[model samples]
Target: MPNIVTLAEAKLFIRVLDDDEDTTIETMIAAATDAVCDVAQAWDGTGEPPARLKLAILSRVAIMFDTRNSLEPGIGEDRLLLPLRTVEL
Candidate 1:
């Protein structure tokens, strides 16, 4: 439910992106999808949860990110993107 990357995975992922710089769009897209899938799998184990539960989890992450980082107050779809900047892992 919560979108998260392991600290090691985040470090490795960023390193690869930084080093490659020219990773294909498809590869980037796959990596994004894999990140989400990793969260979903951990949340439900079966790899799926009810849509409402998924949304609630996502909402919690957004709220936590904004509160924890002091990235502009309030919720907006764009806040989801901001978490990438605020999150440590």
Candidate 2:
């Protein structure tokens, strides 16, 4: 959870506005964190993981929340994650 955004921050970003959905939001945050790390291809980002990555997580969580069952198509997140991606030959 070192580079992941906190529950409070995610709630605010997604405008949860209440504790009723706290558990669900927490789940989304955890999953989103892992997903972002996978996309970045490295969880060992030095210092902070960068704002774009954090925002990408928030956007993903929002998509998860809105879709209810799965993330929406056309998330267009390559820009947020590609720069941080570690290329492998």
Candidate 3:
């Protein structure tokens, strides 16, 4: 599956300018989306990805891009934390 977030959306989130790094950005988007989906168990019940998941994916992608040449990318724990919604039965 392709990334939940679009290339344009990822670019906007990371404030990217030209398309020079588009391939790298696209790769990051796919990886980030996969990570978020895995952590969030996002496909359990969904139409489109929720806003929070999209934000998490975007943030992760930005982190990966910014730290491409450095040490391992460190996405914050908060980004992977899902909100706990209680069910009223």
Per-structure clash totals for the candidates: 0, 0, 0
- TM-scores for all candidates: the values are 0.28, 0.87, 0.74
Please give, for residues 1-89, the per-residue lDDT of candidate 2 as tens digits. 57478888988988888899989998888888888878787547668778888988888888888888876522677788888788888
Off by over 4 Å in 1: 1-44, 69-89
Q: How far is candidate 1 from the true structure (C-alpha RMSD, Å)?
A: 12.5
Where does model 3 exceed 4 Å of error?
69-80, 84-89
Instruction: Write the residue-wise lDDT of candidate 1 on 1-89 in tens digits.
Output: 23333333433433444433333322333344444443333344344444433333344334433354442322443333333323336
lDDT, residue 54, candidate 1: 35
Clashes of 1: 0
- For all candidates in order, the CA lDDT equals 0.38, 0.80, 0.72
What is residue 26's positional error in candidate 3, in angstroms? 0.4
Query: lDDT of model 1 at residue 83?
Result: 33
Model 2 scores worst on lDDT over the 10 consecutive residues at: 69-78
Q: How do the residues 1-85 of candidate 3 rate in per-residue lDDT, one tens digit apiece?
A: 5457999999999999899999999889888777666667635545666777778778888788887764343456354445522
Better of 2 and 3 by TM-score: 2
Q: In angstroms, how far off is 53's CA in candidate 1? A: 1.1
